[model samples]
Target: MNIKITGSGSYIPNRIVANADFAQHVFLDEKGAPLTYSNEVVADKFRQITGIDERRYVESDLVTSDIAFFAAQRAIEDANIDPETLDYIIFAHNFGNVKAGAIQGDLVPSLAARVKHSLRIKNPKCVAYDILFGCPGWLEGVIQAQSYIKSGMAKRCLVIGAETLSRVVDPHDRDSMIYSDGAGASIIEGTDDEGGILAHETASYTYDEAYLLFFGNSYNKDHDEDIRYIKMYGRKIYEFALNRVPQAMKECLETSGIDIKDVTKILIHQANEKMDEAIVNRFYKLHDMVTPERVMPMSIHKLGNSSVATIPTLYDLMLKGQLDDQVLTKGDIVLFASVGAGMNINAIVYKI
Candidate 1:
């Protein structure tokens, strides 16, 4: 059996957070003094470094599951499938729903369960669960759904990746600028057709690098002592992505017996604009093919890194012709890749 995405949808928060928004929230020193820097200077540096002008943030009352619900509705409508027919709801996220003004909290019933309820899905047999694979979580969920379809355990699956990174980010931390909130979803069903999810690869290198990106409270005496936030060694992650991601993508394409030149688009994790560009270029270089200027599409400038939500949301946008000069047609070969907090890397090949 083959697995194909029948429909897709995404929901980005209405709240637009420009780089200038960070100016007022800069971190303070140990003595309660503001860090010596102008917001304009920092904003310009962010643009030059990450190519991000602004990102979205959910309102105080919104949570991860809520955004996922919105995306799911759009996806199901696009697929034109009955909610009762869904056999599985696979949700992917690192931080679950956090209460307004709370730094640490999670959905007690699991995000998948919450989404199922929000959709008013009444089928008791539909298995709903969550997967935690860092940024690769959504792709991993799709992989699991494919396996279920192939084994005849399921006929249709809903895969969702959603996050509210702003809730868990340390406002004082520079990395805060790179995190955002959004959701994306895909409705995948079993098919007898030849083109779908062709081949894939996944990997983890968490032995010593598990802490490269981690969640912990700030130790600064002037900051909130009990609030949890994400922290990372930026240089280490940059080096890891530049070195590992391209090789993994190359191997995945090879496994599918697809030539680099045949690929139509490369939808990579919106981690860093420069890093994603370099990874795609490196993959094509391995095959002695010049990187096509339009081969890779990016939404990071507007969405930042919503962790698992990045790839699928970008994919949805491209499929809908919302991304400038990017579109997908029948029989087009597409590639998906992501890497993040789990010290994880993964890629998938699909035929549209």
Candidate 2:
């Protein structure tokens, strides 16, 4: 059986925080001189690298569930399906409502209640749950739902990814200036097409590299929440991507009976502009394939790195005409891939 994405939706909070706006949070030097770390530098970094100039932040009143529900509503509307008909809902998000007592798993029942109340339907078997996988999450969620549909466990699935990176960011840190909030949703239905997930490959280099990048978590005292704020060896991450991602893509396509030329576009994780260019160039040299347009520039710059929501958010944005249009078409092959903090790299081949 084949699984197709029949609908898509995305949500960004109304509040927009520009790079310059970040300067207000910076500290001054001992000499009474403002630190050199200006929002201009951070914003310019995102703009030059990702082509993003602005990103949205959730208001203090909003949380992950609010974002997920809104995006899910749009996805249902786009698919022209009633919420009561959705057999299952896969909510992919690592960051939960910080205001709540627990993480995403604990927040699911409440979210489901809201959905049930809003749609005025009763779904005892609705089965809403959370999956954690950093930035490669949406694809993982898709793959997981494929299993349920293939087993006849469900007729339709709504996969939603909602993130509030700002919840984990250390507002006092310059690096935290880049992350913004956003969410996205997609409807996956079973099909007979053999082309859905033509190939998928996941690589985990578990070692010190696993500790190379981290999101701050204060709720736990064991890891010292103070150390939980975003921490990364920038140079290490860059080198790892240059060496690892290209090889991962090559392996995925080769096993799928797909040649580089067969691919119309590659939708990679939106880490940044530099990594995007590096992966594309490396892939071109490794497979002699022409790279498609860069789709994450505006997102990375404006939306910052949204973690797990990055890919789906970009997917929703591109389809909404926020990015290049010629890149996606029916029967065209597209590659979705991501590499993130877990030291995990996953790539999935899809057809438009």
Candidate 3:
């Protein structure tokens, strides 16, 4: 019983803030660099690094659901599925449209309303809600949806990763450069076709490492001030990556009963160029696996790090220009891997 991803879509804003333009808005240091030096260098090295050349952000008055609704509409159309058939609408987010309110916490309900309203989904009466867990949130949603569909709980599910990281990023920090606002949706439908989420495995190491990657000391002193904002011990997280990710990948491949050499493409979390290189190089050394040539280049040059959106967005990009060809033959394997701030690493095997 393989659940297949019938359609996948992403929502990017029309705004294209060039690196040069971003330089104008941000302050510079004595060395003629952005106050956080790394972002400055990233901007100088890559044209799209400083600002999303095509990023999406809702107006201050709008909500996350609004952005999600647009993306959901496209995804449903791409899937060629009627909205009336949707059984569940799972909204995933870490940050939302409105701040915590007295009545209903964040904007999850609004997200549901907007999606249903935009698509005019009726009859099956989709239930909507939010799920969040660091950057790995969407991957978890995929697994949950896969289970639900396989269990007969849903015939089709709209799984969304909607985030407004800009809300929490400390305007003063360099680390905040990695977080961005965007949404990605995958239409997972129950089918006899054998190409959905085949296998998934996660490994977590509880640590105060979260402290290294977050901020907000004055506002949330009671909680780890780090949790309130994005905080990262750059070198330390890199070290953790090199140590743990390979093992997780190895286990994922073994559990799927597929050799690494058999994988046609390895879709890694868009954490950073260095992390992807380390994992790709390690796997290549062990098993001659070719990281899909097209997606690898896009990771560094085209899309900066899009957090959870990276794997799915990259997968969508790779699927184009090739779906018509015979390169991705039946029985081929696609590997999806991601690591998040909770000191957790995950890898899922997809048989295409």
Candidate 4:
């Protein structure tokens, strides 16, 4: 028996925030001092490094769960499956739903349960839960779904990755530019088909890397120090990801018995254009080859980094033929990877 992604969908918010949008904002350094350069110089430098021109944000009327439900609905419709038949719904996210103008996360009911409720799935057997694995959350949910299907705990599952980061960002921090809001979902089920998820790998470095990404006080010291928002050591995290992620991908690919040349698409987490490129290049170098053309599809230029939503969101867009020059055909081997908070890393070798 095999587990496969039978359907996929994504929710891209309507609001477009371009790089020029930050021109008048005050960007501060760690010491609470304003940057010496103008916001234009800073934004331009950021563009060159991250390849982000614009990003999406959920309107004030919506929250994370709303978009998660939106993506889930489309995925269900695409799969053409009865909601009541689902055996599980796994939601992956770091920060839960945060209301507009609010600093706290609302998780009284888990996001997965919230989505399951919103989905109107009345089957009590549909075990719903949430996983906080940073940017890899979505892929990790897929891995969990694969395990459930393989272990006979489930036959059909829905895995969703969604976030509304615009509400939680520190407007004063330059790193906030890397965040956006979006959601992506997939329907996974047991199949008799020939190709599916082949192998997966996961790693956690908690000793030295634990604090690479964390929630910290606003960069503007005047802002309440007790109030924290998503934060990271960008350079340190970049260096760490470049060194670790490729090795995990290579190990997963080898475990699948799939040659590096067979990987036609690499739907990596859309973190940063430069970091992702360096990681992919290193992966190929490990195989004694070079990175292949069009093997890597990216959405960061416009979508920015929606944390756990990146990989699944990229997959949904590609499968729908929305991504220029990218498409997935039957029997194509694909690789998915991500590294983020928790200082976590993961990769999956899959056949589509």
Cα RMSDs, all models: 1.7, 4.3, 5.2, 0.8
- How would you encode candidate 1's per-residue C-alpha lDDT over 114-148 as one tens digit per residue? 99999999999988999988999999999999989
| lDDT of candidate 4 over 1-352, digit per residue (tens) | 8889999999999999999999989999989999999999999999999999999999999999999999999999999999999999999998888999886899869999999999888999999999998889999999999998989889999999999988888999999999999999999999899899999999999999999999988989889877888889999999999999999999999899998888889989999999999999999999899898888899999999999888888998988889888888889899999999988999999899
Q: Which stretches of candidate 3 lie over 4 Å from their true place?
A: 25-42, 45-62, 98-105, 108-110, 123-125, 215-228, 286-297, 322-331
Clashing pairs in 2: 2-191, 49-273, 50-297, 52-301, 54-302, 55-302, 216-228, 216-229
lDDT of 1 at 146: 91
Error of 4 at 221 (Å): 1.5
Stretches > 4 Å off in candidate 4 = none
Quote the lDDT for 98 in model 1.
Answer: 89
**How well does candidate 2 match the true structure in TM-score terms?**
0.84
Please, what are the lDDT tens digits per residue for candidate 2 over residues 267-301? 78777777878887788888665565552233576
Model 1: pairs clashing at backbone N, Cα or C within 3 Å = none
lDDT for each residue of candidate 3 in 105-137, tens digit (9 for 90 to 100): 366355656677677766646877676556666
- The deviation in Å at residue 139 for candidate 3 is 1.5
Decreasing TM-score order of the candidates: 4, 1, 2, 3
**Candidate 3 residue pairs that clash:** 13-56, 213-231, 213-232, 214-231
Structural similarity to truth (TM-score) of each candidate: 0.96, 0.84, 0.79, 0.99
Clash totals in order: 0, 8, 4, 0
Q: Which candidate do you rate higher for TM-score, 2 or 3? A: 2
Worst 10 residues of 4 by lDDT: 99-108
* Better model by TM-score: candidate 1 vs candidate 2: 1
